[model samples]
Each structure stands twice: as C-alpha cells, then as structure tokens.
Target: MAGPGGRMMMGQSGERSMDFKGSGRRLLRQLLPEKAALWVMVAAGVGSVALSVAGPWILGKATDLVFAGVVGREMPDGLSREEAVEGLRERGDGGLADMLSAVDFTPGRGIDFTTVGGVLLVALAVFAAAGLLMLVSTRASTRVINRTMYRMREEVQAKLARLPLSYFDQARRGEVLSRATNDIDNISQTMQQSMGQLINSLLTIVGVLAMMFWISPLLALVALVTVPLSVAVAARVGKLSQPQFVRQWQSTGRLNAHIEEMYSGHTLVKVFGRQGQAAQEFAEQNEALYEAGFRAQFGSGVMQPLMYFVSNLNYVLVAVVGGLRVASGTLTIGEVQAFIQYSRQFSMPLTQVASMANLVQSGVASAERIFDLLDAEEQAPDPVRGARPGQARGAVALERVSFRYDPLKPLIEDLSLAVEPGQKVAIVGPTGAGKTTLVNLLMRFYEVTGGRITLDGVDAAAMSRDDLRAGIGMVLQDTWLFGGTIAENIAYGASREVTREEIEAAARAAHADRFVRTLPDGYDTVVDDEGAAVSAGEKQLITIARAFLSDPAILVLDEATSSVDTRTEVLIQKAMARLAHGRTSFVIAHRLSTIRDADVILVMENGALVEQGTHEELLPAGGAYARLYAAQFAQAVAEVD
Candidate 1:
C-alpha cells in the first residue's frame, strides 16, 4: 500500500525494492521496547528445542538395553558357550567373541524391564515438557507482537497529523489509507506468525546439529555439507523471487488506489459514460497484480521442494555411512537409528526457513513503506514568539505580499489590499487570478513568500495558526459536512460550546431551520461523509449556519450561495447580510449581481487589483469589471431563454 511517499512503483526489473539490511535494523529498533519479553520467549523456545533433541538419544539407549538382554538369553539357551564362540570366530567376528567374555547380562532373568521403563518414562516427561515450553513461548511471542503492532499503529496516526498539508495535497487518499491500514496489517501478520516460527526454527536447527555431532562426528560432517548447499539454493531462489514479491505488493496498492478513485468518482463516470474505459483500466491493473502475485509465489514455491531434495540426499548419505559402521560393530543399530532421526530434524528447520522467506520479504517491503511515512518532512514549526490573537479587531491589511505554490510560476505578486472593519470587500477576477490565494494567505493556511499580512495590525505569521483561523469563519462553495447530525455540523466551527438553543437560532438565521425541521429527525438527522442524504442547497445552508454559529470577526464567503436555487439563494443572501452586519467580510463570487452591494468591489485581473470602487462607479468605467459584468448578465439571460 501507498504511504507518505505517495505511490510506490516497482524497482528496476529483477531488482529488489528495499534494502534488507537497513529495513531489518529499523524493524529491530521497532521491537527494542519489547526486547525483554522477546528474550523470555526465546529462552522458552530454546528449552523446548533442547529437551526435544535429547529424546532420540535416550530412546537409542533403551534399544541397546533390550538388545543386551536378548543376547544374554540367546547365549544360555543356545548350544554350549564354546559353540557360540567358535561360531563367531568362524564368521570373522573375533571382536564379538572377545566382548562376550566381558558381558555381565546375568543380573536379571529377563530383559531389564525396570531400567528400560525408567528411561522410557524420562523420555516421555522430557517430550511433554518440551511441548509445554513451546506453547508458552508461542503465547508470549503473540503477546509481545500485538503490543508492538499497537504502538506502531499509534505512531503512524501521530505521524500523519505532523505531516504538512502539502503532503496530503500531493498524495492519493486511497494510497494514504492503504499504508495506514493494509500495509500495517501486513507487518502485524508477519511479525505475529512468522517471527516466532523463525526464531524457533533457527534454535531447532542448532539443537539438531549438536545432537547430530554427538551421535557420530563422521556422519555429522556429512550432514553439515548439505547445510551450505541447501542455504545456497534457498538464497538463490529467494533473491530472484524477492523482487516479484515487492512488485506484487506495489501492484496490490496501485490496484486499491485505482479502485478507490473509480468508486469515489462513480457518479462522474456514469455521467460521462466512461464505464468501459474504467473497466479496461481496472483490468490492466488487475492483470499486473495477478502476474506479480503468480511470479512471487512460483519463486518462493521452488524453495521447499529443492530444500527437501537436498535433505533427502543428506539422509541417504548418513544412512549409508551409519550402516557401514554398524556392520563392523563400531556403532550399534540403535545409534544409527538415532542419527537418522537427528538428520531429519536438522533438515526440517531449513525447509521451514525457506518456507518463510516470502513472508519475510513481503513484510520488509511493508516496513519500508511505513518508515517512509514516519520520515516525511513535517509542517514547519510554529514560532516560539507567536501569541494567540484572542479577539481580532476585524481589520486586515496585506502589504506587497508575493506568494506562489511553485516558486517558478508566481501566482500572487506585489499584491496589496486593505479591508476596513465591518466592510464587505468583494474580490472578482478571471479564473487564474489569485482570489482564493488571498484567502489562504489571510488564514495562514499557506504562508506568503514575501511581505506580510497582518490581522488587527499583528503579523498573521506571528500569531498561532489556530488562533488566526479561529477569528475567521469561511463558507466555501464546496461545502464540507462531516459525518454527524445536522446540529453537530452546524456547530462545526463554533469556538465555544454551543447549546441547543444557540444552534437552533443560528440555523434559523441561516434560513436552514425550516428545511431541517422537515426531516423526520429534524436536527438529529445523520449525514454521511459526502452529505449524500441532503440536497446541495441544504448542505450549503448548513455550512452557512456553521459560519453564523462561529460569529467570527472576519467572514469569507466563497460563492457561498452558488449551489442554492434562486428562492433559497434569496434566503441565504438575507442570512449572509445579517451574518456580515458587523464583520470585515471578503466575498469571492462569479455572479456579479450577488456582490452588487459590496462596500468596495476590488476588480482583479491576473492577481492585480485593476479597479476599486462601488458597483455604480465601475459600471461606467468600461474596464475589465464592466466587461465581466456584461458577460455574466448575458450568460444568465441566455440560460433563462
């Protein structure tokens, strides 16, 4: 999934996307807080492996005890002792005859059942203890992993808040969400299920190697040769497949992003009849995802069979060498049996390690994405000397303020304006003129690159952003109503706690109270994120009510009534007139007639105020404002016809 880095495309073909060494170190650091608990779990796993390793050897000793008892019984029940010795010598088994004289198996009439039973009981206890330890370690690891993931999730959320608004503007919402949810989920799953198994597998391999060496150094050396060979095989395959897994994950993120975009714009797609085009795009992304997934699975899939083959080959070599030693009486049958079990145990963990390679790779890829977000450039820190503008006096002055979203292409340059307290200043210009840019600067959403804007004679930059924004209320054309009841949305920008009576009064002032009462639940109606349940005009009214409730000293209405019908527009204008009665207001409207009553209409062209006067003064100037006004009326007349 995408993160703060936005889109994550695949690396060069066949090249892995992440640096394993760097990501591994970072991942380790993330787990450092839980280190003590992890160590305890590891200790339990080690204990389990140690006990399991001893079981085979003890059973071999028990086998030897039974063999010895059988030999003792056979020697007495057969012909004479001399006959047994001659038979051994004749068979070229002189060593067996010499060992028989030293034998003292006559301590019991039958096999030493008590001794064998004791050894068997001890083995059973050890096995049971090992199982118990394994369970404990598994549970411990689970607990630690869950806690660590929770911390990581919290950090991600905190990091998102610290990020600059520019980051959100550039990053896709779906991609950002993908990182916060899907990518984090992937990391959690891998850490919980794979990490514990990985640790146990390594410990098991070590324990098995120790037992293999103790059984027979010669056979142990033979088994050791396959270790490097198996690892080499796994490494080679994993390297080729690692890129595929990276690509697979990236493609999945892209697919999710595409789906989210298309779904959100589903209405637009239908309006434009672009279903076929959207489906084609979806198919292409899906195919890419499928190919990446298949290749990754196929690459990691080869490791198990290859490791198993290597394991089986090592087992055959050990069996052959062990059989030779046993036949010559240098090693007993029971010892050979124990070595075979050890060899099998040793190879099994390597197979498991190979099996986990894909998960580890995929998890590391997810970690890299998450780390990128945590490492993004944050918003510039607020000045230490900044103070809160508790109550602005509604006076705003812009000096020769120059600003640009991109430095190379200046949008607002050498712009100067003065807004008197309680005056309605209407800003109008062509599409690319800096109408909204001025609002952004005034609110300090984006700081000016040169000069300064002051609110009540205090530099806006010198005031805390929250305080500056608190003094200004905005009703935008694109009304934003979060998921809440009508009353909650209306009280959105209010600085202080608003009672139900205050909310109702604000709604009534905005002319929204009548329509709100028509709903079954009145002010308690639930609105979705997009406010889909309400009409566009109703949403605008709610936003206007929000502005009225805020009752800021400075108000901004950016096409506030653009979405409402003619009848509703008249009501909203009346509400706005009352709301702006005692405030310094900026109205940015394309409908020239709506701003005809503005105290001073600032006719802007290309970010420069070309003319400044009341509506009557600019009507006869035959300037840009006159032309724009004429065109607007003509368009409206044509629409009516």
Candidate 2:
C-alpha cells in the first residue's frame, strides 16, 4: 500500500538533510557561464542605486531652499541672516534663533519660485536616470537567466541519456521525469523572480548606507544596530525551512510517481477491484505533500514579517536620533528629513533580501535534485574508435559471462552460448530463468561482470553500442508506440528513408495488414503512445512490423506472439519462418509448440543451460525439457475435456 511504501520512500529521502549552503553555492556556479551578462547587470544596478541614493539628498536641497525663502519672508527688511539670528537670541526666543542659525535665508524675501523650480528639475532628472539604468539592469538579468536555464536544460537532457539502465531500474520513472521537467522549470522561475531584484536590493543597501553615513554617522550607527538581529532572524528561519523545502520536492516526486503508476494501470486496477485502495494511496500521498508544503511555506513566511519588524525598529531609532540633532541645531530640517529617508532606504532592501529566503531555498532544493541527477554515475563510454567488422556475420558467442543485479545475489554465472550465422535458436525457460536477460547482454544494455561476449570474433564491448545494436532487431512482449501515424511508427525502425510500400510490406509480413486495412485511415491512422485506437494484438503487431521493417541480420523475439489470437499467432509464425530462414534468430517462447521446427532448442532453468537439442531430441530425453512439455500437454488436454 502507498501508506507504508510511501513512508519508506520519504524516510529514505529524509536521511540526507539538505545542504543549504552547498546547494546555493552550486546554483551560483551555474551562472558562471553567463558571467559577462551578470557583470553588466551588476554594473547597471550599481549605477542606478548610486543615482537613486543621490536623488533624496538632492531633493532635500529643494526642501531647504523653499524653507529658507519662507523664513526670510516677514523678517526685518534690512537685516542679514546672522543679524536676524542674533536679534532673535536677544528677544528670548533661542529655539527659533537656533533653528534660524542653521537655516539659509535672505531678509525681506519670500519663497523664490525660480530657485525652487530649478532644484525640482534636477531632482526629477536624477530619478529618471536612475529608472532608465534600472531598466537596463532588468534587461541584462533576463538575458542571463534565460541563457543559464537554456544550457541547464540541455545538460539535464544529455545527462539522462548517459545514465545507465540500472539507474532507472532503481529510480521511479515519474520521479525522474519530475526532476527533469518540474524541478528545472521551478529553478527557472526562481531565477526569473529573484535575480534582478536581489542585485538591485543589495546595491541599494550599499549605496544607501554610504549616503546615511555621510549625512550623520551617529544616526547611521543607530540605524545599523538592528541589522545583526535581522541577519540572525534570516539565518535561523532559512535553516529551519531549507529541510522542509527539500522534503516538499521529494514528496512531490513520490506523489507524481504514484499518479503515473496508477493512471498507467487504471484498467488493471478496475479489473482487480482496487479503486478504493488506489484512492486511499493517492489521498495519503497528497496529504504528505500538503503537510510538507505548508511547513516549508509557514517556516519561510515567518522571516518577512520579522524583517519588517526589524526595519520598523531601525526606522524609529533613526527618527528619534535625527529629531534630537535637528532640535539642537546641529542638522537642518531638510538634512534630518533626508537622513530619515536614507535610513528607510537602507532597511527596505534588507527586508526584501530577507523575504527572498523562501524562493532561494526552494530553488536551491530543486537545484540539488537536478545536480544529484547530473552527478549520478554514467554508463561506461564507448571506445573512441571502436572495432567494426566490415559486415556482421551474425555469429555471437558468450564466454564465461556472469551478472548480478545485487552484488550478493548472483542471477547468471559462467553462462556461455554460441550461435553460428543463419541459425535459429529458440530459448525456452521458466519465468525467472534469465531468458530475456541473455538478449539484454548481447545488446549491451548492461555490462557483464565476469566475462566477455564476441560478435564475429570481435569483443562486443569493444564495439560501439550504436553499431552493435544496428545489426540486431528486437520486439519485446511489452509494446510501445509513439504519437504519430501508424506508418511512421513502423518506419521508426528503418535507418534511412522508407517508402509507404515498405511499411505496408512489413505490416503484411507480420499479419497486421488485414486488421490495419479495416481502420478508417488504414496505414495513416493516428495513434498516441497508448495506441488506444487498436486492440492489444494490433499494437503488438505494429511493433513486430517495426522490427520486420528493420530487417536486421539478427532478431530477438521475446514472447513476441503472446498478445495475439492463436490464428494470428500461427500466421505470424509462418511469416517468421520465412523471414528467419537465413537470419540468426533468438526466440524466447513459453509455448513449446511454436519452436518445434527450430534448428536447435536451448532450455534454461535457474540461470543454467540444462538442455540443448532439437524439440524431438529433448522431448524424449526425459529431462527438464521433457517434464515442462508433459506439463503443458496435460494442461491442454484437461482444458479440452
């Protein structure tokens, strides 16, 4: 049930805690290839922040100019600013005199509209330049993010192609697919949302801090006292939420795997009356995902408000300090106003950076999953210049070969077989007898642990996998069809361009032409991966037709006729008899009657070659093959009765 198996998967996944710092660093390294673009973005950000920082200071001057003109009005007509301040001190209004001492005013003057307008124009220009630079920074960040994700996707795809088949055996298909699709997309979104803003925010903090210190060092220090507390909040919350993010993505993968498995086998579930069981499993996985997602979100969500609280505290501190300086006449009203703005500017970016913890952590979590895939051990590479026999003679011989999926439990050991050119070898065995595994070894889907296999006296391992597989054609019991026309599906097997006539010829040879002609579109009928337009037998026939179209020197048929009716099966057998006459064919079958005319029949039991001879020779020997034939014959007779 999903309740226990899913928990076990979560347990296995949770065993490795998230390396938050390591993953973040690796994500940054992903951008190294786009370093030039990042530098452009950073330079633009710095310039924008610099001008932005100066705007407040410049605007404060306009405030001073306006205030000075107002104060100058209604003053005595002939007194200088110093004379008026002295006059106010003598009149027992020392507070006004102190403020006047700091204010620049001309006696007998009202607000000067010309000077005020000029300062306002300068302020507008400064801010507009800052905005234009920000636009440039944003554009550059977009280029960097897009290019980086483009390359990352390409790398992930290529990595999947290089991974060994054994890796997929151990990994869940939907989980791997999610990592390649969903996780990569998540990473792309994270960069898109965070990269440019983070750059601007960080540069804003630096530029704002400089202006704050230049205005008043004491107030700047007062504003900075709460920064350590903000940092502590961010780090602690990030640590708590980082593992939750990792678990969330893992849960997503497990849930996806379950959905894919159930949906793919829904027909079987219905036949077995397991709908309740399936729904319960789905509910359990969905619940696990909800919990993980909630915790990760709530944990990271705590940081933004905390940072806001810290920013407010810093704001209050700067206002109090700046107000005191203004009252004492050490700083002007405009300077204190500008200093208050600078303090806010400094704290806002910190809050933004703190708030980004969620996106950053989630993105890094996905990056780690993708990086794990990229870091997995790849299958051994082919030789640069591999051995190539000019033409394959269809001679394959295994010498003392051995293999084990698990190191401790051997499946096949010291098994050897040789097939001469143009020989039809029928391999018959029980379910766990390694009959299909023999074909896999010959095709080099897996590497043997102990011995070597040779084709035409040249080592198979020395030959490129592409070259080796090109000479052999395989039709599995499990059929697959992509989304395309039926004719195109058959043509997939051909290495070069194939005509419509060739596709029809292959279909006829596989006995599929009659049924295919009944369809509305005949060879041109469109079918998806499920091949729902046709019966299971027709799907199998299409795959068999594909193999026929290839016309390789060697053929591997693994229960290839199992899905068809007996009449169709007999027709396929007759066709195979004609086509396999001069080809080296390895046929694995459960029905012994199908291989009665084989040149030789090899019987495997528990990974050992126990009997080998013609059907007539082995049936009378009274060994493993004789017992198997007797059991099947008895079953057939009893069914008839």
Candidate 3:
C-alpha cells in the first residue's frame, strides 16, 4: 500500500490502538539484536537519573542538618547524637572542621556559610556527573540505532535480490522501491529518536516516583493521581493515530506507484495524446494522500499538548497538599521543595513519552510491511544435483508437455516435439500461438503443468536451473542493456573474465563493431538508461554479441531481427549463421524469409505444429504451410514485376 509522496497513514482501521503487546515486543526484539551497546547505554541512563534524583534529596537533607546544628544549636530533630555523628562521618574530612566551627547559636540561628558552600559544591558535582552520563548514553544509544538501521537496509536489499520474478510481476515496482527505501528510512528515523528518549523517559519516571514516595507517601499518592488518567488518554490517542499512520503510508505507496507508472510510460502517453487524463489521475491520487496524511499527523500532534495540560493539573494538586503539610510543621520546607521538584520530574517524562508515541506507531506500521515482504514464498528450488552439459549433444525433447499460466486456460496443450542434436529448428507462428512460451518452458522460466521436457535424455526439471540455463544462449525480441560501456554489455553473460580482444571479437561477429567504434568512446563509452541513447537495432546487436560471447551449446533467437531494418536484419542473419554453425538452435520469427534456410521448419497454429518439414517438403504437402508460402511468395513476385 502507498500513501502520498511525504505523508502516510497507518492502516484501514484508523481507530485501532497501537498493539503494544504484539508490535512493540517484536520491534524491540528486532532492534535489540544489533544493540550490543544499548544495554550499557541503558545502565548509564539509569545511573544518570539516579544521580539527578539523589542530588536534590541529598542537598535538601544536608541543608536541614546544618540548620539544626547551627540555628537550633543541636542535632537535627529526627537524628540522635549517634545519627548526627554518623552524618558528620559520611560528609568526610573535606572541610568538616570549618563547617562545624562556623555554625552560630548565640545571637541569630542560621547555617554556617562554609557548610552551605560545601553542600552546594557537592550538589553541583552530582548534577554535572548526571549530565555527563546522559550525554554518553545518548551518544551510544544513537550509534546503536544507526547501526541497526544500516543492517535493516542491507537485509531488505538482499531480500529484494532473492525475491522471485513472479512477485515483481504482481507488485508495482515503485511500491516495492518505496518500502525498501523511503519506509525503511522512516523506520530508522523513528528508532534513532525514540529509543534514547524512551529509555531516558522510563528511567526518569521510575527514579522520580521512587524519590517522591520516599520523601512522603501521602504527597506521592497525590502526585500519581494523574498518571493513570494520562496513560488512558495517551492509549486512546495512540490507538486512533495508528490506523491513520498506516493509511498515510499506504496512500504514499500508491502515489509513488502512480507517478512511476506515468513517468515510465510518459512517451506512450504523449504519443496517445493522453497527458490531460494522466494529470487528472495523478491529481486525484494526490488528493486522497493529502486527506490521509492530515488526519494521521493532526491526531498524533494533539497528544503532547493534552499530556502537558494533565501534568500541570497534577502539579497544582501536589503543591496545595504539600504546602499545607509544611505549614502544619509536619514537613520541612526543604522536603516540600524536593517533593515538588520530584513531581515535575515524574510528569515531564510522561509528557515526553506521549510525544514519542507517533514515531513508535509509524515504525511499527513500517515493520509490519517489511515483514510481510520477507515472508513471501521464494522461487521453486532446483532439484538436479551436479547437473552439467550432458554429452554436449544439444538434443531437446518435449514429451506430452502441457502448460498454463492460469489453470482454466491452457496456452500449450499436450505439445510434443523433438529437435536432434545440431539441428537448426525454426518455429513460425502468428501472435499468441505460444512461440515465446515454448522457449520460456525450455529455459525453465515457468514449470510445465503436465508431461516433461528432456535435454540429452535427462529430465529438464531435474537439471540445475543454472546448469540448464548456462547451456542455452538467448537473444530476445526486446533487448535490455545495462548502464555500462559497450564492452561491458558484450561480456555480460561470459562465465570467466573476458578480455577486450574477446569482447571486440564477439561484437564483430554480431556486426555491432562498426557502430560501436564510431561512438565517442568506442567500446568504452557508457550507455544511458536502458541504452535509450542507442538505436533499437544497436541494442539488439549488443544482446546478440553477449549471447555469442557465452557460446552455449544451444541458441534461441526469439524475434531477434523483428525491430531492425531489412539491411541490418540481413547482417544479423549472417551473424546468426556463424553463431549457430555447430550448435542446436531454435529460431522464432514473424518474417518467413528469415527461417526459409532452416533445416526443419515447424509451422505452428493455435499452439500445435500444423506442418513440419524442410522448405521443399512443406510446399508439396499443400497443407497450412503450403498455403502460407503460396500467399507470401505470390505477393513477393507481384511486387517484383
């Protein structure tokens, strides 16, 4: 599924809450595999939060102790002489005498300035240490996130390479490309931002709640009243946002697919004068994407503000309760101050968690899509073990073979044929007579539904696909050229490294050397996309050169000369003769002249061999072959006169 170019929703049921139990655990597992550094970072994060919470409480305790010792001229109210001595021992020898000597009790009760300075210094040290820990953990967590993203991208790409051809046929190229590139990028972004924040937020929440309860259970109870309410609201919002995000992503994929299709077929569209229609269709798709994106992002955007508002309400409640306790002399001002700070710390992390929900939801949606692709069935496994060219005989036989792309409509029914080793067999037929399909079956692009094909008396299906394919060289009607130099295209299918001399020789054999040499870079010139800069005949010749370089035992030329001019076709035919000298060959052509010299001509009609013989033998039969020949030759003679 695709959404718009930039904005994407989650899925159809836009109200479904994030499945924390299902997707959250799965995503964590996926991320954890590469997060060897993350566990250390998590520990550091906990330490940072611990230091932060401890600094405030320790400072508050130290302040009250100094006030009691100096102003009250005794140990703190709750501490006995033994406890006060222990507190002094814990403070260590660092400025202990100066702090004890500066406490004043005669005139006005107050803490020694020296003792306050020492406490402030210790608090500052703890705060600085906490900051350092946070920085290290954040940096380490980010590295883990980036490494995990890189691994995911690589794995997805490898999966694409191994995927079956049928999957490509059924799915849109743009949609697949978006998943592999854009969607994965989004997942990476989400992971990088959310992982560190999530860890820090969780640690902060735990640390603050523990500190609040330790200070005063009653105040802590009041502070936590909003926690469940905030969580409930967040859960509802997240549930509503998940589907919107799924839909947004789906619409984005569809938009990308539409754009890809339109651009790839731009020439055809213009030629047919359908630009207006194409633009209209694109606009409509774009509008649908816009709607989905707005709904998904807008919903997620409201969650953070709502969370903050709830947190503020809880803060006011905590303040009012803690102030009354302080006024009644049950709680010290220092303790009340610490409680308020802890309450804010607790609520702050909740707000951050709420803010990160959208990214988490988006990542889950992307992960689901990626897993779906990874789970698809791969190509059928090759059965033959240690298969190689058997005897180099080049004989092919189809025994009662029946095939169908769809079971309801058979394309080739019970077709049986045999080609002797080194025999040049030409198959001529009208469109849809299964000419190309026959060759495809021989090459094992598709498995036959019934019967079997044999090569050198060995079952074709039993042969290793690579071995079977390596033995046959093909030049298809629509030639494809990669974006590479001329020499590279010619050496495309060679098993071993090919030299420049060999590449040139193959090009010469295919009569492609003349044009290739005339180019600006000769054989080293790079071709544009699909060789769009070159003529169709030039591309075809390059494909022929590639096949010639392979030098297979069998050759199949499927409409190889159909797109070329007559003069070029003649040259190509000459090259084909040289290429097929001692190899078994199958030629499929629309033009009658190209295959007239073939050793055996099989005229096909409706996927059946209606006539089979040499040229002279077929003319005398007065069957379908004779009638076709008579009509063609009669027209040729009339044109000559």
Q: What is the lDDT of residue 281 in candidate 1?
A: 95
What's each prediction's TM-score?
Answer: 0.90, 0.96, 0.85
lDDT by residue (tens digit), candidate 1, 1-78: 232345433221234456776986898788889888888899999999999999999888888778767776766454
What is the lDDT for 223 in model 2?
91
* lDDT for model 1: 0.84
Models, CA RMSD each: 3.7, 2.8, 6.9
lDDT of each: 0.84, 0.87, 0.80
Considering TM-score, where higher is better, how would the candidates rank from best to worst? 2, 1, 3
Candidate 1, after superposition: displacement of residue 71 in Å?
Answer: 3.8
**How far in Å is the alpha carbon of 85 misplaced in model 2?**
1.5
lDDT of 1 at 50: 97
Instruction: Give the lDDT of residue 104 in candidate 2.
Output: 89
- Which stretches in model 3 have alpha-carbon errors above 4 Å? 1-24, 58-113, 384-386, 602-611, 615-641
- In angstroms, the error of model 1 at 307 is 1.4
